[model samples]
Target chain A: MKRTDVTARLLPKLVKASASAEQFAPSNIALCKYWGKRDAELNLPINASLSVSLDYLGTHTRLIPIEGQVDEVWLNGQQLQPGARFSRKVSAFIDLFRRDQTLCFKVETRNNIPTAAGLASSASGFAALTLALNDALALDLPPEALSILARMGSGSACRSLFEGFVEWRMGQREDGLDSHGIPLDASWPGFCIGLVEVDAAEKAVDSRSGMQRTVETAHLYQSWPLQAAADMSKLQQAIQERDFSLLGQTAEQNALSMHATMIASWPPLLYWQPDSVAAMQKVWQLRAQGLELYFTMDAGPNLKLLFQRQDRDVVLQHFPNLETVEPFGSE
Target chain B: MKRTDVTARLLPKLVKASASAEQFAPSNIALCKYWGKRDAELNLPINASLSVSLDYLGTHTRLIPIEGQVDEVWLNGQQLQPGARFSRKVSAFIDLFRRDQTLCFKVETRNNIPTAAGLASSASGFAALTLALNDALALDLPPEALSILARMGSGSACRSLFEGFVEWRMGQREDGLDSHGIPLDASWPGFCIGLVEVDAAEKAVDSRSGMQRTVETAHLYQSWPLQAAADMSKLQQAIQERDFSLLGQTAEQNALSMHATMIASWPPLLYWQPDSVAAMQKVWQLRAQGLELYFTMDAGPNLKLLFQRQDRDVVLQHFPNLETVEPFGSE
Candidate 1:
């Protein structure tokens, strides 16, 4: 109680700070879902996961250097007070940038992608923040090192720094030095993600909390980590071979399996809305009718269809609302 | 070509009926979802399952014994043409009654619950049809014998005949003698089911075909049978002990696990609608706020909440539209 005399009651906000920067990072759709955490301290995932970074949807975060001690945050251009949960989230994320503890950095993050709506905004948001800070602080960290730092902010964020296909390998080391995104491929030229965004009114339970609850309660989750590892290898090979059918099938199964673990958790967490179910059924119907396409969903209602660039017309014919975003590294 | 077989083309709808009877059976919500099949010929489930028959919603079938080559099916008073899929299903079902194959009986079935919407109308439908046929055909079958016969009609239908907690055990024998619903308890006095009905414009893939695909693929489905058996026993004991917390938690987890198996299938079968997800979220939110309740969904969008009668007022407060049904056997 006596310590309040000399010390600040709260952590410092960016009311007054110095260095600042701005950067953009694309969103990623997990072909393999990251459903559980092996280590909560380092934000390490239980299973290795693969994702394709999206070129269309992304987060553009601009760091505004304020002169105050406490860091402020503005998301989607809305001002967030210093001590709020969101501001603290930003400050805590920026604090993960190794060399800075004394100086406060205000982060102004805008998501073209919706935040906390199962759209993987956290992935793009933290990825953008980490990358911007990299240039601003002149960290000179390579993609792998930066991925490790980004993972400290959000598990899926590590995969967003890379352009094309990325894998967040759940390493065995306790220090999490090896737990970082490995760029699987720089190009998936013929494949595109047909993103059907579903605007859910409420935010889902965040991935962190969802994973924690799943790991603690879901008995069926015991076998998922090993299964994901096997799937990751098969998918990587499928990509290398340019086998669209194999790649699409494995990605679809992987996404479903990941959701299964969460769905099996005590009190269950279901991410699919009615529209999501309808969209999935439609995908099945299309494939049954000889359409060479597959679909996967993240933690939210937005569905990503993996189909060839050649079959884009047919896919568009069925899902007129699907926003076609070229796979990362396609441009 | 041979002579045009025009004379046998027309099968009489209701030529000369010897016996007829009408019966009603309530729909059952599977707490432990049955996904795969061990014996398709006998309609045996791949795993043991537990279910609670809903008192509020049911099916009523009127058996019209007809002297014809084939059975005609009239669902909700609409006559289905002979040799159609629905007629064939009815014919095949009635054929399991151990009667002369040449004796065709017309089945007029009506469901208070929606059919094929995942609310398990087939279970109730087949159960009522079988029970009615038992009386009409003068087949003096006990509940166990009738359950086995119902199982041959539809896998889940075996559980619909009994009240309170029921388990459909996947028997050890290949002959399927022991694989029938064993009523765990006759009454759960304090409990009630809050039902939220959702309308689906289209029918999902029926359970039979869905199970076939899931069993053939879905790497995670291999261990579900044994896991389900284990869960069945634990759930049975929980119901016997009247431990609502343990019962509710296990039921919720078991339902999710069953859905997980299907969701992980080759072409994932998701039965939840938007309203289904919303209702489930509401249940989780209620539990978090210290409400003692649990939820489970069948293969459709409709959701059933299990809570004590004492908690009915609060449950109704949140879900004013929820149809409150007392536990079966309470009357």
Candidate 2:
């Protein structure tokens, strides 16, 4: 099914623009990673995933209705050229909302995440863009509808729509209407995430292409759906019970399993740098010494450490430059 | 079936020792790795494996009958204490030969593979020791029988009995008589191996325990037997056809797949250090620029680069300190 058909079915036929709209969406780190796709066109996942939203480190997007024929995209005070990949992607996403009507938008987005952290901004970017579009057009769609829309921009963006613990259910439908993020009620106040920046360089292979290549060439990827399902259940139980050990272990293993598939792929996709291994070894060494620290990695080299508030000082002692974030703390 | 039972069925009922005997055996690198074991006692593999023997980089052993209550073991000019793990293992292997007889021998062995290369000496060590014992006792066993005996000491040691390409067939039987290395008739003269040592430190987990842990804990290991089988066929075909690309691609992919299973295991086995990753990235970058260089890693941080002789200059230029070995060259 086409993305336009899904959007058309959910959105109103006629909508008037509010003067302007602004929205904020937090970035999310998947505890159970979303690796492969069941439907690439609609960004439908092959397996369910769970994540924790970063409280204050995210993206802020402001949308203004414009009279020009083309959408103008600006990021961090710099306007993107129309032919730039980032600008083109934003324009395509905006096109889905302004079908048939001659509507153009001026999009301004700023990410609060530190550049050295090497975190992907697409998750929060798409999520915030979707929310701003909904508000500017006076669509007033529910959270599920907004999440499904954001997912069309980027798969992980669906999880970024919610706060605290969120689960993206891989729905059993061709249209992908049921697949959206749901926020879990449980929250641990002292839960911490330590960002260890290994490298700030651009990735050789983006996650979208990397996921496709792994699904196509990695024979061991056959077992990944089952792994994701098991990890998702474990993560949910850990969150509900506040079991830090279970949470940390499951998250670390889940990330490693995802990376295993990538490494086993043909032409091998390795996103780790030398410093990435050093950081991981440091975490493992500290854990062996009874510090209770575990780490998760995405498609990039940086590591996101999972620990509690009690062990924060010790973790920082080893990783002196670690950027600490309390996911549940008041900003 | 017990290892002793297998040995008893193969060896002669009575044998007299020679005054002294010496032997030499080259080390072998697995193109298709021998990973999981079906029978730990007899060292029977779960799947077939293939390897190429290094021409001169190997082990030399001298065995002399001595009048003593216990055997004395010396390695590289240093006498090993009886209680040391290496000494105990060597003594246990010797005990298998003198079942009912009270025969003692002083054994001295040396490995020519440079210490910094971080290659596992067990394959060459056991193969040389087995050959020397056969000559010392006047057993005069066939190559298959010798390969089978060497396997009981270390699984990959079976392949070290041959000079060029070898295949260790995973025979189906309770006695494991048919499971032995056979030298292939094909030869590729230009084949080269470059050793890139990342770290020479002791591994946190030995291959024996690591393999056991992976088989028990890694769900993805269920797919390994199938992968090995497929890679073994491809490698044999590559050798016969002398297809450099096919040989390099299959070997590299097979090694990565094995590491993938370890990474998917609980408590994740990662042998690649920071420098290992850096070396791998350099290889990939060079390959992208039209240099046909590929790499394979065993259960360690070091990488063994596979290329033809023509590309040696370019490979050496990139890795200045690389230890180059022409596996098929006359030493």
Q: Residue B161 of candidate 1: its Cα lDDT? A: 87
- Which number leads on DockQ? 2
* CAPRI classification of candidate 1: acceptable
List runs of model 2 lying over 4 Å from the truth.
A16-19, A200-202, B16-19
- For residue B259, model 1's alpha carbon misses the true position, in angstroms, by 2.8
> TM-score for the first chain of model 2?
0.98
lDDT of 1 by residue, B1-331 (tens): 1001111121123323347799998888877778787778777777888888877578899887677677778988899988788788787666555344466677888887634334767888888987887777676668887887777778889999887678888887666767889887557787787777777656777778877887787666765775577677777778788888887888788877877878887767777766677777788889999999897766666777888988989999998877777755343
Q: Residue A222 of candidate 1: its Cα lDDT? A: 75
lDDT of 1 by residue, A1-331 (tens): 1111111222232223345678999889887778777677677777888888887689998876556677778888898888888788778666655223465666788888643334767888889998887776666667877787778778889899987888888888766768889887457776788777776656677667777877776666776776687788888888788888888888898888878878887667776766777788788889989988898877767678889888888999998877777874353
Isolated chain B TM-score per model:
0.87, 0.98
Question: In model 1, what lDDT does residue B107 have?
Answer: 83
